[model samples]
Target: MKSRHIKAQITSFCFILPALTVLALLLLYPVVTSVFYSFTSKHLIKADYEFVFFKNYIAVLTDPDFWTSFLTNIKWTITSLFFQIVVGFLAALAVDRIRKGKSFFRTILIIPWAFPSIVIALSWKWILNGVSGFLPNILVKMGIVDTVPQFLSSANLAFPVLVMINVWFGAPLIMVNVLSALQTVPRDQYEAAQVDGASPLQSFLHITLPHIRIVMGLLIVLRTIWIFNSFDMIYLITGGGPAGLTQTVPIYAYNVGWGLKMLGRSSAVTVLLLIFLLMVCMLYFRILNKWEKEA
Candidate 1:
């Protein structure tokens, strides 16, 4: 019996060994190398390097650009999260209450999420173009402005527009998650509330909200991390343009590492961002655990 159990354990390990090796090579290697590179003064094009200890970290921490990018990241994540959750929740509620053409509505709403980020960015860019874009042309015809305004090029407008675009792209994910959770809510809960003469709003608040709260909390945490580290949409849309207003941490790191060829400093930025994200994950789990306990 012991020999059979040992053989079974070895068989399980053999089955997973290839996947474990791939993960180590692809994920763990880069992370470890990046950490090592963060402490050295290395440039992308230069071969020579000197050990810098904490100098790169100090420089990154003290840099104004880093702070600006960090704050912008915070704003981007928070604003996108709020709008996505609100819009997605409303959409889910509406869809949940609908009986006819439900699948059609869901498919249509999820189209934005299915589209490639680059494609979405390019489409929005053309639509919002200062020169002969559809939206600006319409506004011009209405005499809102004599000439087209550059939505993606204006510092003040660019960030908000990027945020809105992110909200559009991300809301579908929240909608799908919330909708799935909503479906799992037992029908009897609503029926019981109805029997007790509960209003529609009351039934939703007392029955629906509690049932889906866990899913909502988890989704928010996941989306927060994704949005915080997001690079592609904003990069494709604005390229961190119009005086670097939309440069989140990842974009800033890319600019530093690739554009400026400062690999060491960029690695430091990456390390800092990783640390921040880890702290966020810890806080999120802590809060989530407490909520679970209370419930």
Candidate 2:
């Protein structure tokens, strides 16, 4: 019997070994290579390279552009995450209350999240374009402004507009996840609260919040990392233009590696991002663990 059990275990490991190998190649290999290159004088196109021993890290840390992009990344992550959670949670609540056509409404609500990032970015770009755009032309016809709104160009409006677009794109995902978590909360608890004469707000504060808190916490952590590392939407829409007002760390790294051909410095920038995000995730997981204990 013991020999049979050992054979079963070996068979299971054999089944998963190929997946593990692929994972290591796809994820670990690039990460290890990036870390190794970060300490060297690697260039994007040049063949000659040598160890620089932290010079790349120092250069990236001292550059003012890097700091600016870091700050912009923080703001972008926080604002986009805040709105995504609120709007998503509210929408989930609204949809959950619907007695009829719940599936239809849920499907319609998640349509924004169904498209690829490229599609979303290009669609929004055309809609908000300064000339010959639907939204700008409609606003002008309505006499909202004398001139067409440069939603993606004006420095003041660019960051906020991107945040709004991100929220629109991301909230639906939050809604779907939160809605699933909401379904798992037993209906008896709410019914008991109602029988005890609890107000809707009171029941929500006492019961609903606790039940979905962990899911929301996990969502926040994942979304924070994703939004911070996000490149496609902003790159496709604005290309981090208008005086670099919308530039984030990923774009900064791209500019360093591709535009300036400083692969070593770009690797250093990515390493720093990895360190920061790991720290953030650690903090989030600590809080999540505490919540789990409380539960």
Candidate 3:
């Protein structure tokens, strides 16, 4: 029996070994290399990388562009996550308790999320384009704005448009998850509360919100991290343009590494981003764990 158990453990390890090896090579190795590079002067064409311990990091920390991205990320993260969670919850509520064909509507709405991100971004770009587009034309027809609204072209307007697109794509996940969680909440509780003369709002606040509060928190944290590291929509729409006003941390890193070939600087930025995300993940998981314990 002992021999068979040992053989089973060994067999399992053997099965895991291939995946472990691939993970080490593809994920761990790149991470280790990036951490090493973040502290050095690892230029693109340099034959020898001089160990300039923390020089790249110092540059990154002190750069104005870094601060810009940090601020933009903060704003984007908060506003986008707010809308995504609120809108998604409302959508889930509507779908979970509704008339006939609500499930079909739910499926149809999630189709935006299923669409390719680049396609969505570029399609919005055309809609917001200055020269003869549906978005500007409608606003002009409605007499809302005397002009085309300058969504993509203007720095002030570009970020909001990007956020709108992101929220549109991202809200569906939260909606689906919240809808599923709502299904698990006891219908008997809702009925009992109703019989006790509890108003709909009171029932929701006292019963529904408490039951799903942890899931809501989880969704908020997930959305925050997702929006914080978002790259594609803004990149596809503006390419971090209009004089770099819309460059988030990810796009900034991309520009530094691929565009300018500043490998070490870009690596430092990537390291910082990873660290920030790690902290957020820890907080999120801890909250979820506590909720589990309480439940």
**TM-score (C-alpha, index-matched) for candidate 1:** 0.96
> Per-residue CA lDDT of candidate 1, range 5-79, in tens?
999999999999999999999999999999999999999999999999999999999999999999999999999
Q: Rank the candidates by lDDT, best first.
A: 2, 1, 3
How many residue pairs clash in all the candidates, one count each? 0, 0, 0
CA lDDT of every candidate: 0.93, 0.94, 0.87
Tens digit per residue, CA lDDT, model 3, 141-218 = 999989778888787888788788888888898899999889878999999999999999999998898899888878
Error of 3 at 185 (Å): 0.5
How do all models score by TM-score? 0.96, 0.97, 0.94
**Model 1 alpha-carbon drift over 4 Å, by segment:** 143-146
lDDT of 2 by residue, 1-295 (tens): 9999999999999999999999999999999999999999999999999999989999999999999999999999999999999999999998999899999999898999888989998899899989988999999999998899999999799999999999999999999999999998899999999999999999999999999999999988999999999999988888888799999999999999999999999999999999999999999999999999999
| Alpha-carbon RMSD, each predicted model | 1.4, 1.3, 1.7
Q: State the RMSD for candidate 3.
A: 1.7
* Ten-residue stretch with the least lDDT total in model 3: 41-50
The C-alpha local distance difference test score for the whole of candidate 2 amounts to 0.94
